[model samples]
Target: MSSETDSSLPTVAVFGLGIIGSRCADQLLNQGYHVKTWNRTPKERADSESDPISAAEGADYLAFYLKDGIALREVFSSIQNQLKPSQTVLNHSTVDLETTKWLAEQCEEIGCSFLDAPFTGSKVAAGQGALVYYVGGDSEVLESARQVLEITSKEIKPLGPVGSATVVKIATNLISASTVQALAEALAITNAYGIQPEVLTESVASNASGSVLASMKLPTMAIGDYDTHFSLENMLKDSRFALQLAGDAGLETPGIQATSAAMEAQCKKGHAHLDFSALFKAYDTA
Candidate 1:
C-alpha cells in the first residue's frame, strides 16, 4: 500500500482508464493532485506500471469509472485490504441502486466513505471538464469531495444518500434512450414524407419539444455519420440498468422497454460498437 502524503494537495486514485476515466485523471493532474490510475488490462492503463491496488494505496480519494457492477465488485475486493479508514471512494459508474447501496455498506464497514457520483455528458464534456455529476452520499462526504468533483465536473447535484445517484442516472439514461429513439422515428417519418431531414431538424430544434440530443444528432444523421463517442453496447447496458431499477421499484417503464428492444435490434445487427445514435439506422433502413 502506498503512503498518504503530508502535502496539502489532495491525493487521488482512479480506476478504469477508459475515455471518461482518462479525462478525469487529466483534470485531476491539471488541478495539481497526485492521481494514480489503473485499468483492467495493462494496455488500458494510462501508465502500465501502476496497478489497481497500488494506485489506490494511501490515497485520500479513490475514484472509479468501472465498466459494470462485476468490475466494481472485483476492484473493491482487490483493494479491500488496502483501504484506509475515512478514505472516500467515488463511483462514477452507471449501475443499479442495489449494487451501489451494497458497495456503500461494504465501504462503511471498513470505516471508509463511498459516494455514488455517476456522471452525465460524454467524452467531449469530460475532456472539457464540463460534465455534470449526480452525487449520492452523506452530506459531509459529498462536501468533502466537492473540490475534486469540481475539477472534473461543471455541476454536482446531491440527490440524497447512498443509492440516489444511481436512481437519477437511470432516469437520465431513460430520457437519453427515449430521445434517440424519438429522433430515429422523426427522421424516418420526415424522409418517408419527402421532407428533408435538415429542414425538419432545423424547424423542430427551435421548438419547445426539441432537445439537445436532437440537435446534436441531426447533423450526424443527415450525413449518416454514426461513429462512436458513446457505444451502443454501453447505452444498452445503461438501458438494462434503468429497466432493472424500475423492476426493483415495482414500476413499469414501457417506453424504456421499447427503447431497449430497439437498441437490442441495433446491437443484433452488429452495431454494438458504434455510437448509440446509430439506432437511427434501424428506422432509417426500414
Candidate 2:
C-alpha cells in the first residue's frame, strides 16, 4: 500500500492549480517534496510546473482538486497512462459516492491506489493548511497517504472504504447549509424588529445556541460584507447532492430542499460568487 517506490519521500503531482490544489502543492513543496502542478486554465499556473501528463510522470502520489466528477473524467484522458501502478491518487473534490467508487475502480484497473479524501473548510483553511479531511479507502492506503494529508489538514478522519468519505462530506455540507439558513432566518427576524445585528450576534455568541457558524460569520454580517469563504453556488450544489442522497435513502429532507431553493434564488440574483452568508441578502431584500 505504500505509494513510494524508493527509500525517499514520494514526489507528488497535483492536478488543478486552483485555491485548494495550489495550497496543497505549496504545502508539499514546503515539506521538501518535489511537487508538480497543472491547471486547465493556463493562467492559473502560478510559477509551478504545468502539463497534467508531465506532472504524473514518475509521481508516487497523484492528487486531484477537480471541481467535480465531470472534470475528473475529462482529466483522466490526459494522464491515465502516466500514473504508475503503485502510485496513489487522492481525490479531494466533493463528488458523488457512485462516481467516487467508479473512479477507485478505474484507478485499480491501472494498478493505482485511489482514495476519496473530500474536504471541508474553504480557501481560507486551504491556504492556512487547516482544512478537515474525510478519507475513504483501504486502511493501508490511507496510512500511506497520512503524512502528506497531514500537512494540509487539521483533522483527517478515515470514514471507511472508497466513496464513504464523500458521503461524510455531503453530510457535513447538509449541516452547514442548514446552519446558514437558520442563521439567516434568525437575523432576518431580528432585523424586522429593528434590533441591532451586532447586539443579536453578541448575545447568540454568549448563549447556548451559538455555534462555530455564528462565531465565524457574524463579523461579516455586522459589516454587511458577504465575500466568499464558501460560495452560495457551491453550497447549493452540495445541498442538491445531499438531498439526492436523502432521496436514495428513502428519507425526508425538507430542510435541505428549502436551503437549496434559497441558494438557487441567491445565485439567480447574481450573488453566486458571494459567501453563503449572502443568504441573508435574499432575506434582507425580500
Candidate 3:
C-alpha cells in the first residue's frame, strides 16, 4: 500500500519521541500524514505538543512509542477521557504482557479500538521504515491502522490476539540478549586462548549457531563500539519481562536468568544507556 497524505491524511498523535519514535514521526510527516508528537521530556520540534492530551486531541490515531508499561499507563491515563470510539490507539512500544492486556481493557472501556502492536527493529531500521510489527488485536482495527503502521514497517505481522504480540516481542528479546552474552563469552574465551576475536566471528558466521545478532554485534563488540542502537537497560527490562512470562508458565529459563543477571550488573556499572552489545564490556580486559 503506497500513500501520500498531504492534508487529507488521518491525523496521528505520536507519543514518545525516542530513538524509534522520532524517526517514525519524521517518516510519517514526510509521507503526508498529519503528525502530532509529544514526549515526556519536551523535544524541540514544531509538531510536538507540550503534553500528551494536546498531542492526542483531534487526532484520528493515538500511537504510543513509550519506554515501558509505567510510561504507557501514565500517558494513557492522562488521555483516556479524551479518547473517542472513532479513534484508534496503537501501542508500538514493547511492554509487559500485563500492561498490554491492561491497555486493551482501558481502550475497551473507552469504546475505542486498540492494537497490541509492539515492533522489532531499532534505530536504523526504524529510520529506514523497515521495522516489523507484531500485531495482535481485532482484524478490523488492524486494517484501520494499517496505513499508519505501514509508514513505519516493512512487515505487519498479525500474530493472534492482544497480549500475544507482547509475549513474542519479549521472547525474541530474550534470544537477542542471550545471544550477545554468548558472543561476549565466546570472544573472551578465544582471546584468553590466544585466538583473535575476528576469527571466532568468522567461525560463528559459518556455524549453524550464527545469527543476524552475531553478525551485527560481534564486529562492534570487538572494537568496543557500544553506540546505542538499543540500550542495555531496555534489553535488561525486557529480559526480566521474559522471566516473568516463564515463571507464570512454570518454566525454568536458566539461560535468560543468567543473562538478566549479567545485564543487571552492567546496568549497575552505569552502562545502561549503551548499546545492549555492551554485554561484551563484562569481558573487556583492556
The candidate scoring highest on TM-score is 3
Tens digit per residue, CA lDDT, model 1, 98-169:
779889888988999889999998888999889999988898998888988998999999998788888889
User: Which parts of model 3 are misplaced by more than 4 Å?
Assistant: 1-5
Between candidates 2 and 3, the one scoring higher on lDDT is: 3
In order, candidate lDDTs are: 0.84, 0.82, 0.92
* lDDT per residue (tens digit) for residues 1-286 in model 3: 2345688789999999999999999889889888999998899997989889899999999989998999999999999988899899999888999999999999999999999999999999999989999999999999888888998999999999998899999999998999999999998899899998889989999999988889999989988999999999999999999999999999999999999999999999999999999899999867
Q: Which residue window of length 10 is worst by lDDT in model 1?
A: 1-10
Model 2 ranges with Cα > 4 A deviation: 1-7, 44-49
Models sorted by TM-score, best on top? 3, 1, 2
Clash number for each model: 0, 1, 0
Better of 1 and 2 by TM-score: 1
RMSD of each: 3.4, 3.7, 1.8
TM-score of each: 0.93, 0.91, 0.97
> Which 10-residue span in candidate 3 carries the lowest summed lDDT?
1-10
